[model samples]
Target: MLELEFTAEDMARTRFAISPLWEVVAGLRVLLGADEQGLHRRWAEPVRARIAAAKLDLTPLAALVPPPSPSVPGFICPPPTTPWPSLEVELTALRRTPRELLRALSPHARPGVDAILADPDRRLGELADLIEAYWEIAMAPYWPRIRTLLESDILYRARRFAEGGTRLLFDDLDPQLGWDDGTLQIAHRYVRGVHTLAGRGLILVPSAFVWPRVFSTTDPADLPVLRYPPRGIGTLWETRPSPASPALAGVLGRSRARLLTELAAPATTTDLARRTGLTPGGTSQHLTALRASGLVTAHRAGRVVLYARTRVAEELLNGAGA
Candidate 1:
C-alpha cells in the first residue's frame, strides 16, 4: 500500500485537471494490447487501423508508457498548469522542459526514449512533433466526447466536496483508494511508500483511457498527481437513440416524459438539458419529479450523479412508448 501524507496546506491547494496528453499515452496503450477485455475496443480498433494507414511510428511514445518501466518519467508528462490546457500547450511545455532535468532522467531508457533524452535540444523537438502527429490521428478526432465525460466527473466531484469536504470527494474515486485522517492510501503492486506532501497539493486528473487502474506521481520533485478512470467510461463509446417518439409524453406530460425516454442511457443534467432542448433548471425540476415517482433513478458515478430509467419506467416505456 502506498500512502500519501497530506499536510493541512496540501488539502487546501489540491485541485483537478484534464490532460489530453495523458489520453494520448493511455490510448496508445489500448492499441498496444493493454486493453485486456477490449473495453476500449470499439474506439481502439479504428484508431489502430488509422495508425496503420498513416504508418505512424509510435515507438518513441510507447517507451514512455510501459516499456522503459511501469513508472513513466515526469519530464515528458508533467502536471498541467491549468484545469484544461490544450494539447499544443502541453506539447510546448514538454518541449521546453529543462535539458538538465532530461539529462538527470536519461539513465536506462530504451533506444527510442534514450535518443530524445540524449539530445534534448534537437531530438526532443522531434519527439514532441511525433507526439503531436500521434495525437492528431489517435486523440483529436474523439476529443469532444472525451472532454465532456471528464468535465462531468469534475462537476460531480465539486458537489461531493460541498456535501462532505474531501472525505466525500474521495469516497468513490477508485476502489484502490482510501482516505482517513489526513492520509490517502493507494493499493498498488509496485509503487509502495509513505510520502509527505509538505505544501505542493495533489492534482486529481480523471482519464477515459486509464480504466481498471490508477496512477499516482510519487516523485517529490514533480507536482503530485492522481490519475484515475472517470465514471461512465464503460458507456463512453455507446451511442444513444435520437430523441425518442413522443408516445409516453401523454402520461408524464411532454417535458417529464421526454426526459424519461432520454434516460435510455445515463446522463448528467447539463447533457440532458442540451439534448432535450430544456433549460437546465427545467431539466433538474423534471428529474426530481421523475425520481420521486420512481420512474427514474439517480446513480452516483464518481463526482456526478447520472440519471437512468428504472425497471418500472422501462416497463412503462415498452407498454406505452416502446
Candidate 2:
C-alpha cells in the first residue's frame, strides 16, 4: 500500500542537491594550485583568525585535530567521541527518507544566490555563509566539530579563489582562458543556498558552517560511514605536470577544436555538453587536457564548471601553420 504522509519539512529535503558552492571551491582549486595541501597551508592562519573572530570558542576542540601531516596536510585528527548527534541516527534518517532528512537538516530560509554575489561588498560574506550552510546540511551529525574546522577552511578557500581569479582576469588572461558559464551557474546555486540558510536560524552568523564532506576521509569513530572522492581529480591528472602524451594530445586536440568552435561568451562543461552533444564527464576530460596544455583555464562562476581558451589556446587555434 502506498502511504502518503506529507510535511513541508519533508518536501524540502527531497529536493536538496549538491550545493553549487562546492563546485566553486573546486574551480578555485583547479585554477590556483590549492588542491589540498596547498589550500591547507595557505589558509591555516586565516582559518584560525576567522574562528577566533567568530568567538565560537573552539579551544576545547583544538586538542583533537591531528598534527599537520604531509600525507594528509591540514587534516585534523579524529576526535575521541562524535561531537554532534550519533552517526547511526543521522544515517538512518538519511537512508529511510532522503528528502525528510534534507529538510530536517537544511535551513528554512531563502537568500537567492544572485542577490548575494551581485553585491561587491558582501561577496566574501555571502560565500562564507553559503559554504558554511551547505556544510551544515551535508555534514549532519558531525556539525559542531566539523563546522569549526570548516569555518576557517571555507573562508580561506573562497578568498583564495576569488582573489586568484581576479588576478588572472586583470592579467589579461585571454577571456577564452577563463571559466565558462556553467561553472558560474553552479557557484550561484551555492550562493543561494548559503543566503537561504542565513535567514534561517541554522546559520551561526559571522561564523561560517563548514561541510565535513570537504574532507576526503572519515572519522574512524564514525564507522560505517559514506566516503566520497575528494576535491580535484588527482588521478585524472598525473602527479608531476608535464606535456601530454602524443596519444593524449591527439585526443585533446580533436575535442578542443570542437569545444572552441561551439563556445560563445565562455561556456561551461554543461553548456559545452548540451551544445556539442558530448556527455558532461567527457567534456570535463577535454577541458582538463586543455588545462594541462596551458591552453585553457577553468573557474567556478557558480555551480557549473566554466572553461575558456587561454591566450595559448587562441594562438594554437589561430596559428596559420595549423
Candidate 3:
C-alpha cells in the first residue's frame, strides 16, 4: 500500500498532464509481457513486427523497464509536468537529466544498464536518440486514438474534481486508489510508503498502457506522480463506428457532420485532422462553420483550444441516431 498525505497547497498544485514519453516506456512493458493484462495484445503484435523490421534497439529502454521489477529509475523519463509536451520536448528533458539522479538505477542493474551507467553523458544521449526512434515505430501512428481517449478522461475527471474536491476526484479514479481526510492511498504492486506532500503537490498522469495496474513516484526531486490507465482502455484500439448518421451527413456536408461528431469529446483542430484524415486547413474551416452555427464551442485547455458539442448539437445527435 502506498499512502500520500496532501496539504492544502498540494491540493491546489495538483494537476493533470498527458505524456508521450510515458506511453513509450509503459507500452514497452505491456509489449514485453511484464504488465500484460491482454488489453494490448493486438497492439503488441504489430508493434513488435515494426520494431523488428526497423531494427530498433530496445536494449537500454527494455533494461530499465522490464521483466517486472520493483521499481524503475526516476531519471529514465520523469513524468511530464504539463498537459501537452511534444515527444521532442520530452527527449530533450531526458538528455538533460542531472548526473546525481543516476543513483536511482544503481541497484539491481539489468544487463545493458551497467554499460549505460558506465558513461552517463554519452549513454544518456544515445538513450534519448533510441527513444525518439522507438516512438516513431510504436507510438506516433496510433497516438491520435490514444490521446483522444486520455483527453476525454482528463475532461471528465477535471469536472468531477471541480465539483466535489478530492473525494469525488479520486473516488472512481481506480480500484487501487483511495482518498480519506487528506491522504490518498494507492494499491501499488511493488511500491509501498507513506509520503507527505511538503507543499510540492502531485501530478496525476493518465496513460494508455498502464491498464490493470498503477504506478507512482515519490522522489523529492521530482513532482510526485501517479500514473494509471484512463477510463476507456478496453475499447481504445477497437475501431469506433461512425457517429455521423446518414441524415445528419445529408443536412450538413459529410465532412462537417463528421467534424461535429468527433467533437462529442473535446479535441483540437490538429487532433480532429489526424483522427478523421482531414487536412488541418480543411478541419479549421469546418470547425469555424460549426462554431458559427453554435453547434460547437471552443474553449482553451492549457496550450490548445478544445472544441466541444453545444447542447443544441447533442440534442441533434440523439434525435439523428448518432
Candidate 4:
C-alpha cells in the first residue's frame, strides 16, 4: 500500500516519459530469472545465451535487482524524462549517485556491491560499462520496436487524460493503481508507505520489459516515479505478420495495405519499417500517400511523428472484414 498524496499542482504536472536506461535495468530482472517472468520467457531465452556468449559479468547488474525485496535502491534506476535518453546521459546520472544512496544499497550486496561502495566513482564506471555492453547485446537490436510500443501506450494514455482527466488515466494504468480525491495509491506487495509529492509531481513511465508488476522509487529524495508495463507487450516478440486481406491488398497494393493495417495503432516510421519489412524511407513514402488519401493521419509527439488510421480507414477495414 503506497499512498501518494497529490496536490492539485502535482496532478496538473504529472507527465509521461520513456527511459532507455530504465528498460535496460528492468530487462536485467527478466534475464536473472525467467520462471516468474513468463511474459518475457521468450525474450529471456535468447538474451541469456547472448549474455553468456559475450562473457558479460551479470553479477554487478544482478545485484541491483534483488529477488522481490523491499530494499531495491531508487538511485540505480532514476526516472528518465526524455523519450530517447542516450546511454551517456543515463550513465552520467549513475556516476553521480550519492555515496549515502550506494551505502543504503550495500546491505543487499552481491559479488560487486562491496567494490562499488568502497570506490563509488570507479565502480560506477565499471557498472556503467557493463550496462552499455549488456544493452548493446540484448536491447539495442529490438529497441525501435519496443520504443514504438511504449510510445503508442503514451499516445493512448494522453488521449485518455485529455478525454477524462487524470483519474481516468491513472485508473486504467493498472489494477494496483488508483486515484481518489487527491491521492494516488499503489497497492504493491512489498512497498507500503504514504508519500507526499510536495509539489514535485510524478513521472509516469511506460516500460516494455516490466510486466506483471509495477516499479517505483522508494527514496523520498527522488522524484515520484511510477513504471508500469505498457499494453501490447505480449506481441513484442512477434514479428511475423498476419497476411493482409486479399481484397484490401488488391485495391491498395500489398505494401500500402499492409502499412494501413499496421496503422491500427499509432506507430513511428521506424516501427512501421521494422514491422512491415520495409525501409524507413519507403515506409514514409507509403505513409505520405496514405495521409494524402485521408486513410491515415500523422501527428508529432515530441521528436517522433506517429501515424494512425483515420476513422475512414477504420470503417474501410471493418467493411473489408465483413
Candidate 5:
C-alpha cells in the first residue's frame, strides 16, 4: 500500500462534479471492487444493457460529449486500464470506460474518482464519474443527434448542485461547459476555504420572445438583443438564424411572433401551456430547449417551472411582431 494520507478536511473538500450518469457509474464502481483491470467489464455490461433496452443508437450520443478537460490540481488516478480502447471505442462504448479513461487522463477529474471510491456512501458516489464521462463523450462523432437530451441532462444536474448550496459556476467562458453537484460541492468547498473570496449571484434571464420589459429601462444600449429570429418546429430548437436583427419586421411569421408577445408576463409552465393550447410536456420541452439556447429561462417556484422570455427574447419581440 502507498500509505495514502488525506485529512478529514481534505477529504471533505474533495467534491464530485459531474452529471447524473456519474452517480450510476460511481454506484457500479462500488458494487464492483476490482481495480482498473475489471472496471470496464463491470460497467459496460449494465450500460450496454440499458442502451439495448432503450433502443438508442450509441453513435449519435458519442459525438456530442465534450472531450476530457485539462486535469485539475491535487488529483490522483486510480489504476488505469490495460490496453486502453481506441478513441472510437472510448467515444461510443456502451459502458463508462471512456469517462474513466477521462479521469485517468487528468488529475482534477481523478480526485473525484478517488473520492467516490473512498466514500462510504456507495450509491451517490458512483454517479460522479458517470456524469463526468457523459459530458466527455458529448464531443464525440454523433453528438448532434442527441444534443438536446444532453443539454437537458446538463441543466438538470447543474440546477440540482446549485440548489444544494454549492457554488456551481458553469464555465461561463465555455458555453458548452456544465458542472454537477459533485463539482459544485468541490467548488463550494474551495470557495469556503479562502477567507476573502467574493460571493457571487446568479443572473436570471428569461428565454424566448425578447421584449422591452425584460431589459433595464435605464440604458438604451442595454436593450435586449437577438442574433436572429426563432426558426424551429419541434419542442427542440431546430431552426436556422434569420438574416435580420431583432429590429427587422419580418423576423418570424404572425403566430410565432404572438408567442413572444405573450411572454412579457412571467408565468408557470402550466399556465403557459393552458394559455397557448400546448401540452404541458410540449411547453416544458420548448422552454427547456429555449433555456439551453440562452433565449429563455425556467425558474422553479414552489412546484412549477416558470418560463419567462429572456432579454434576447424581449429584443426580438419588440419590433418583429410590431
Candidate 6:
C-alpha cells in the first residue's frame, strides 16, 4: 500500500496532462517483453517486426527501460504534461536529471549512467538520438490514433473532476487507487509506504499504453506523477466500426449514422474526424445536426467539445440492433 498524504493546497495544485514522449517510452515496454504486455500484442507484433527489419540497435533503449524493479530510476520516465511535449523538451529535462537519481536505477545501467556523467552533452545527445530512432520505427505511425485515445480519456476524467471533484476523479482512475481523509492510497505489489505531498502536489497522466498497472515516479523530491491506464483501452486497436444499421443510415445518412454509433463514449470533433476519416469541419457540422436533432449532446471540456449520445440516441441504437 502506497499512501500519499495531501494538504488542501496540494489538492488544489494537482493537474492532469498528456505526454507524447512518455507514451513513446511506455510503448517500448511492449517491445521489451511482448508476452508480458499481452494487451498490446496486435500493436506490438508489427512494431517488433519493423524494429527487427530495420536492425535498429535498441541496446540503449533495452538498458533504459528494464523490467519493473525497485532499482529502476524514476528520472528516465519523467512526469508528462499536456500540449504534447516535444522529444527535445523531454530530453532536455532528462539531461537535467540529478545524478543521485541515476543511482536508483538498475546496477546494469551504471555504464550508461557513467557515460552520461563523463560527458553530459554528448552522452545525452546519443540517448536522445536513440529515442528518436526508436520512435520513428515503433510509435510515430500510430501516434495520432494513440493521441486521440489519450485525449478522450483526459476529457472524460475532466468531466468527472468537474461533476464530483477530486474524489470522483481519483476513485474512477483505477480500482487499485482510493482516497480517504486527504490521503491517496495505491496498491502496488512492490512498493509500500506513506509519502507526504509536502505541498508539491501531484500530476495525473492518463496513458493509453501503461495498462494492467499504475506507475508512479520513485523520487519523492520530484513532483509526484501517477501514470495509469485510461478507460476504453480495450478498444484502442479496434479499427473497423460495427456496421451501421441500414434503417439508421437511411434516416440520418451514412456519415451521420456512423458518427452517432462511434459516440458510444464521449469524443471530440477531432477524435470523430480521425476515426471516421472526415474533415474536422465536416465532423463538426454533423455533430451540430445531431445535437439539434436531440440525438446527441455536447459538453465543452476545456478547449475541446465532447459529444455523447443522448438517451434518445441510445434507444435508437438499441432499437436498431433489435
Top model by TM-score, which number?
3
Judge candidate 1 against the unseen true structure and give its global Cα lDDT, from 0 to 1.
0.80
Winner of 4 and 5 under TM-score: 4
TM-score of every candidate: 0.74, 0.24, 0.75, 0.73, 0.23, 0.71
> What would you estimate as the lDDT of candidate 5?
0.34
Q: Which ranges of candidate 2 are over 4 A from the true structure?
A: 1-252, 320-322
lDDT scores in order: 0.80, 0.33, 0.80, 0.77, 0.34, 0.76
- Considering summed lDDT, which 10 consecutive residues are worst modelled in model 6? 297-306
Q: For residues 15-115, could you state the per-residue lDDT of candidate 4 as single tens digits?
A: 88888888887888777662384887766776676667667777887876755554455666787756567768988898888887666654655444667
Q: Give the Cα-based TM-score of candidate 5 against the true structure.
A: 0.23
- Order of all candidates by lDDT, from best down to worst? 3, 1, 4, 6, 5, 2
Q: What local lDDT does model 5 show for residue 164?
A: 52
Q: State the local distance difference test value for candidate 2.
A: 0.33
Candidate 5 per-residue lDDT, tens place, 26-113, comes to 2233223312333233233434443454444423222222123211211111211222222333223323333333344344344334
Backbone atom clashes (below 3 Å) for every candidate: 1, 28, 0, 0, 42, 0
Give the per-residue lDDT digits (tens) of candidate 1, residues 1-322: 9999999899999999999888887787778877887898877776676677678777777776763256567777789899989989998988888867766774454545667766777877887898887776666545656887898899999999999998999999999999999999999767888999889999999999887889789677888999999989898888565444567776679888888777665577998999889999999999999999988776543345567676577668767844
TM-score of 1: 0.74
RMSD of each: 11.1, 21.7, 8.0, 8.3, 19.3, 9.6
TM-score rank, highest first? 3, 1, 4, 6, 2, 5
Whose lDDT is higher: candidate 2's or candidate 3's?
Answer: 3
Residue 92 of model 5 has an lDDT of 30
As for candidate 6, its clashing pairs are: none
- Residue 288 local lDDT, model 6: 95
- Candidate 5 Cα errors over 4 Å, as ranges: 1-257
- Per-residue lDDT of 1-322 in model 3, one digit per residue for the tens? 8899999999999999988988888888888786546888767876787688677778778988885676667777687866788888888888887766665554765455666768978998999988887776677556655777788899999999989988999999999999988999998877788998899888899999877888898987678998888998898766444669999999999999998777655567998999899999999999999989988876543345667667677678768987
